[model samples]
Target: MTDIIIDGGTLTASRQDRVVRGLLLPYREECRSNIGRFSFAPGVVEIPQDLTGMSLNIEHERERVVGAVTELRETPAGILATFSIAKTPAGDAALSDIEAGRRVHLSAEVAGVKVKDGKGIAGSLFAAGLVEKPAFPSATLLAAEDTSDDEDDPQGGDDTETTHSESEYVDEDGNVWRMVVDTETETDGDTTTTTTTVVEEVTENPDETTDTEEEEDPMPATLAAKAKTPTPPRGRTRQRPSIADDLPTLYATVAQARAGDQQALTLLAALTDTKISGTGALPGAGVLQESWQGQLWQGKSYDRKYINQGTLGTNISAAGKSGFKMARGTKASPKTKLGGDWAGNKTELPTGTANAEKFGSTLARWAFAGDIAREFFDLPGGAELIEAMFRLIAEDYAIWSDEKALATFLKLAGAPVAPKTYPSEYNDSLGMLLQGILAVKRAKDEPSFAIVNSTAYEQLLYTPHEKVPEFVSFDITTELRGTADAGKVYVVEAADSYFVDADDDPLVDEGEPAVLVGAKAGVEFDELGEVPFTIDALEIAKGGVDRATHGYLQTFEIRPESFVLIGSAPVVGG
Candidate 1:
């Protein structure tokens, strides 16, 4: 015989025959019913002595048949049997039918002997092998008994509670078999007393057994004790203040008012009026008052008496009145106050000395004209003009011995002499004139000629001339009123135009107008079209031939004027 432990319990079987017989009986009955044959109830039938091994056959109603068997066991009570079963079919119909909770029948056989209802028979045999029954509390019965005790006690004494607590039990399998809690309350004089008792049943593994099951570590005694105690009274959680809940209709009313509903506004006004009456002041009243009295009223006229008369309009009216009075009191002609008449009449004003003083002022104004012109035109020639004017004055002073003449010359030259070397009044006037000239020049696309001088001419002419290569080496000639000396008049004969090419010939007709070559690495021509040439040499053939030679052969030829070549080298004879 072999001993076997069931799930947390023990059993025994003595022989293989008994084990097989015990397991197959239930399945045999199931097969009989499934095949539509005689129904059979499985019972304690002895295993056939000829049996070798156990087998099960499951037959689906309209499908196929399948089966499996538990491994044979020998225990003190009988064979302890456990196994799984499934369906066999060409399709998955048997499995699908089983999963859908359809009933299936299974048959069991040991060797040549068949048993009925094997599953039920085996389950009963396994149950009979347990050495002891598992103990568990009946929760419903316990609760009912406690209620009955409380009812019996009426006032509820501590003795009944203690008796309920002491009836708890625990087992060695870590299962709580029973637990009870009891409370009693007593009052005397001005004091009230309450007592509570709790009992729990706990199970732990035996010391001789190795505990494969995990144990929950005990909580700290204080913590466990605290957990068993009742909680103290506390007020309910506070609710958050919700704008929507407190003022349910406020948002909707605002939306309606915005849609031009006057009822909402009227309601709001009534509410405000009621609040104002209760408090003697409206909310935001100061803001409303300021908005109406200061902002809104100030934006519009309250009365015509306080309306503004603009400063410009008043000034214009005063000016008109003064103009009218002056027109009536004086003659129709506008008179020059300095003794020059409006009519063709010259007044007998101050003579020589007075005239000289007046003339001096005029000359001073004129002398500053150059500075004014330079500033107005934005030209560097302002200083040049002033210098020229001063030079003229100095020359005049040297020629004329009279102080008055010298003074007059200085005035006309616009060079202030003495006390004010540069006149402040003239300086301001010059600045204004300079601005005006610059404005005119910008609009007209023409240079201001107000302060022309040699430096100015040189800048305008030569500066631009440098941009045109043809004019770079040209001896420009202009007619002179005096000397005709070769050095002074005609230094060397040359055209203000020239050709540019890789060779001296310029690869163009000699009679053609000069073509300008751009700074880009290619030669361009106005009359002939683009020339395919490189600047290999430049030659000055004075009073002779200008030509180019390739190797020993003449490639091009040209006639020459007074020779001068500024760039490249001279080509030998062609």
Candidate 2:
């Protein structure tokens, strides 16, 4: 009987003569026999088939089975095997050839085969796709291998045992088995020795098997590859709705408002009240003058008339002892009189005075009045009124001083003028006073004092006197008018005129006789005499040409006076 020794962990078988039959065989038949509950560890497994004295060649180009065969078993039906295959050209080709029903035969004289746990035959055969159905039974079983001194034996002689607490499997013989081996190597001299030990448990029961799935990798998605698109950010929009469709109505409403429609004011008031607070007093408050105006008028109390008037109104005169005496005596007299008269006569005076007194009173009341009074009026205008009164006083003093200067100048100049009468000329002191008053008024009215003729006063002061012109006359004779061609040219004799000066020397005794020439062009003479002088042809031609008709000539001379040339030239075409 010829026994097929499969010393390698697993082996594959196929019928060489019938490829279809071999292909039809189950994969379990491809496993080695007597592999009994095998284990894969850190090292390799070797199975040697004795082909002594027999020539045998195995085609292992198919790569279905390569690298370490994880498990090998024999059953009643067929061989069962599993391998951890390597991706190599020869292994792939061997698997392919086996799957195609290529058969490998052992030697005729060869005995049964035995597999060892070693690096050489086990690693090479398994890497060559001789095994089927590879598996990793446990973490320990993942590194199991065989190493023994059995050179001739097909299987590696024996396996080195490992010490570990957890056993991966238990066989029918009650021996605990491990699945994985961790190998370590030591070399002494030229020989190298390797030792491997099982490290973890393994299980074959399908129900008890633990599935360890790898973690999911996080790969970045491209912008184009993402499934969902991102939404754009929200933008701000105007609160009001567009009036495009009702533009005409809107324009009509605006026009009506501009024309002072009452409804517009009502609408504005409503909108303002709702959208803006404290706008009710705006219209009335805008028209109200500042309290400072009143305060400024109060400052004018320093004036003699204003003070006198204030005294008269508030003072009580004692007709009996020593002329008139103040009711409050000398000390309080001025204060009482000024204050009382300011209060009483304020309404009778000019608006400026009344405003000033009102401002002063407002300030005084705020500063001196009881807290009860302050609370009653709320004192809102107190500070403003005080400021106004001070301004009014300052402005009034300025006006009074200017007027006083004018009065003094007028008295010195002997003008018995009343305060009401204003001077017109800038030379008068009264005029300066009026100017000051007018300037202040203009400043208040125009704010900028812009409409003043700045040079008027200077021009009035430096006006120049007009000079009188000297009168003289000359006579011309009919013989002096010598004629040339009527339309072309003519010559007028030059006439000389002179004015006698009493201071001038006699003509015979004169240093150089004063030459008198005619004002008309092209005529010259030494002295003014009754004699006729010759004129040029060009002058005669110029004199004959009408300025209106010739367009370029301006004037002509006719002895005594210059004449304006007029009349049009005859049209040649017409």
C-alpha RMSD between model 2 and the true structure:
44.2
Poorly placed runs, candidate 2 (over 4 Å): 5-88, 91-129, 134-177, 198-574
What tens-digit string does per-residue lDDT give for candidate 2 at 267-367?
Answer: 11001122222555544545655575433332223333111101111111222112222233243232333333334654664222111111101000001
| 356 Cα displacement, candidate 1 (Å) | 99
**Root-mean-square deviation of every model:** 39.1, 44.2
TM-score of 2: 0.15
lDDT (tens digit, per residue) of candidate 1 on 56-138: 32221122223234443322112323233333352244333333334221122221122232222222222111111211111
Q: What are the lDDT figures for the candidates, one per model? A: 0.25, 0.25
